[model samples]
Target: MSKLPGNAGVTVLGDKSVEFYRDPVSFYGQRMDRHRGRVFLSRILNRPTVFVCSVRGARELLCEKSNIFQKDPTDLMTNMYGDTIVTTNGEEASLLRLSFSSLFTGNSLESTKGYVTRICEQHLKDLSSRGQCSYSVYKSLGTQLVLGLFLNVNPDEQPELYQEISCLCTQHWHGLISAPVNVKVPMWSSGFSTALEAREKLMAIIKDKLQNDKHGLVGTLGSLPLPDSSSASQHLLLFISALIPKALASLLTSFTLALSGNQQVETRRKAQTDADYLGFVLLEVQRLWPPFIGGRRIASQDCTIAGFHVPKDYGAVYISHAVHRDPEVFEDPDSFRPERWGERNAGQQHLLCSFGNGPRSCIGVKLTDAFLKEACMYLLQHYDWCVDPSTQALQYKWLPVSRPANSPTISFSRLDENPPGHSGS
Candidate 1:
């Protein structure tokens, strides 16, 4: 195999973690230009890492040779989520997946649709009246959905408890992104430390739910054949995390922005009426604006990805943004054209890594799809929206969760008052 294009650089001072995290798109874009290839070497978290930015490379790493590139044991996800499936590997991981996936598929999943619709209607019904909405507004709706679905913590029934858990989840999430240092001094503590404390409180709440409330996901998870006693609680914590809500909100926000304005009037009308067209619209939204940047793995043994050599123990990261835009796979990769899904990219959704690919793809993807469709359709049927001020910046930040940097305010108009016209007809 050909050697990786760029140098991994020296350890420590040569590490590019900060730069990569700050703006991974620019980092990979500049390097992809310099090295003239999608696969390259860099030092991330002070380890020699292979950055995969092409569709072929990502598929090879995540699908064809998935076993050879396992999840990192020391991933920050493990630190925050404990020994949940997000960090586990091998047969243990498989077992965890089989056990937990039951909660997200088939009957269990079918049961969530009604709740999803209710929550979407509950929080979204007032958007047109408010006249404006922001990322946080959608995010709150998402938060209520996951918290209620996963832990049975209804915001309306127990508002104070719901608020407390939400705040704690936010703290715990901050820890996942913060420096791992556990320093504490004189009424102050590191974000990671604060996150751990928040985790403990959240765990207590999760445990109580699992015990007293023998219903919903918490109840079902408690009854699963998990590895150990703490398994259910740990996984519950992962499920009820702020991460899910943020991701949900990210996709919803992107969908709103992408189909906004009079220009997309015909598109929105079609999507509202045609299920396949709406699916295409959602697919396009995910393609252009995936919630997470990408996922990381560790090379098990020496391997070749996209024809480039990757040494054992080396970190491997796939940039979903770049992979989805690989011109080799997507024609006019950067444009917002949902019809491309119907034409060129038809039946090729597997190529997209928005929720990842292969055996290790997200277990919660189906549930997420159900919720997103419910929320998006709700918005489509009830209201039409556009950026509140036409001149507002719509630039996006990819980290933590992808959304407009300024949290662009959107003006929503009830469709009943002002129906969308069929521009083409």
Candidate 2:
């Protein structure tokens, strides 16, 4: 067995050192190609770690033996989420998952569709008037869209607060990347404070809407068959925290990509045929730029995987980025191909690892798809947009989420000259 440097519990094959603190996205494609079907173990300080890179290996670690392999609770997620479903395991996790499943059911999705469409349309209108904007469009658009879903607040109504909230979420996400070390940072402290303030602001909105019982998203959530007061409040907080960051990240990434694509020529008809093009794009992005690189599991007892010896209490980390981009599984794996996810192959789209597979798969997948679809449809129909080619080579930072190190600047012009519900207006 290979030994890691400095007595770190991690062991890498040959000279391939494990990089726990480094942003995995920086070498995402390369790592997948080099280490597919191999196991590389390293220690982040004193924590024992393992990185499984192949699709089959990851499946065994994440799905088949998931009970033994569990999610490690980073200080950041634990601080923000407490023992919420995203960080928990076993029966408690399942129960919490079940309690909130209704919020994302088919009927719930249908109900939110119109609201999503309206929000998307409203944001597009705002962007159209600007002609061009450079502040992280994904963060801006996603904040409003997610806030609408959570509290029914329009993007226009809370632009400043939304911006702050987006920043706070982004900061918190970065905290997760740095993990135990970041928890001690002064910046992390300030970010948490900001997040708490934002939460208060959000709760205030919810409280006000709860009092009014108005026809808003909060009103809708208020009407759900919630558990007891404590559980219900916990549910609300967890749901908001869990979703806000991801929704914002996905929306921003999608918006950035959409705006960068060929938008000068009218392509409304093409966009409609792919009603969920944004969702597809986001899915592809998740595959390409997964925020979380590894899934952890503790060995229940001595076991061997792929001829590697394991002792009881050993922890395994399934490197999802490596699995998602494995060349053997995906053709031209580095290229973005949304068409591969069309209806015909939707059933065959199991190779992606944005969401883990089997019982632990992300529960929010359906809702995410809904939000992505709506955002994509509205943007494609209403704007002619493109990325600045000079900025095309922008680097991405992998923290709380994968985002351009610099905000992707995009220009947009209204397709208002073309009528709504018509292609190429």
Give the number of the best model, judged by lDDT: 1
In candidate 1 the C-alpha lDDT for residue 274 amounts to: 96
Clashes of each: 0, 10
TM-score of 2: 0.76
**Residue 186's C-alpha lDDT in candidate 2?**
52
What are the Cα lDDT values of the candidates?
Answer: 0.90, 0.58
lDDT score of residue 205 within candidate 1: 92
> Candidate 2: where are CA atoms >4 Å away?
1-19, 26-37, 133-135, 154-228, 242-247, 251-255, 258-269, 275-282, 291-294, 304-307, 339-346, 389-392, 416-425
Worst 10 residues of 2 by lDDT: 1-10
**Model 2, 1-425: lDDT tens per residue?**
33321222434432232344456544444543455435655454345555666676677776677787666654356655556667777887777778667777767767888877776676667775665555355545666666667655554677776565555555544434333431235544554554555555545544655667556445665665543444444444555553455545644564455436444243334555665654565666667767555556667776654455555666676666677767666667776675666643365456655667767777777877677666766666666666744556567665445566676656566676645543221
Q: Encode model 1's per-residue lDDT on 1-425: one tens digit a residue.
A: 89888887897989999999999899999999999988899999999999999999999988999889998888789889989888888899889998888898899999998888888888999987887888898889989988999888887799999999999999999998999898888989999999999999999998888889988877787778999999999998988899999999899889989988888888888999999999999999999999999999999999899888888999999999999999999999999999998898999999999988998998999989888888889988988788878899999999978988999888888877773462211
Clashing pairs in 1: none
Report the Cα lDDT for residue 131, model 2: 54
For model 1, the stretches where C-alpha displacement exceeds 4 angstroms are 419-425
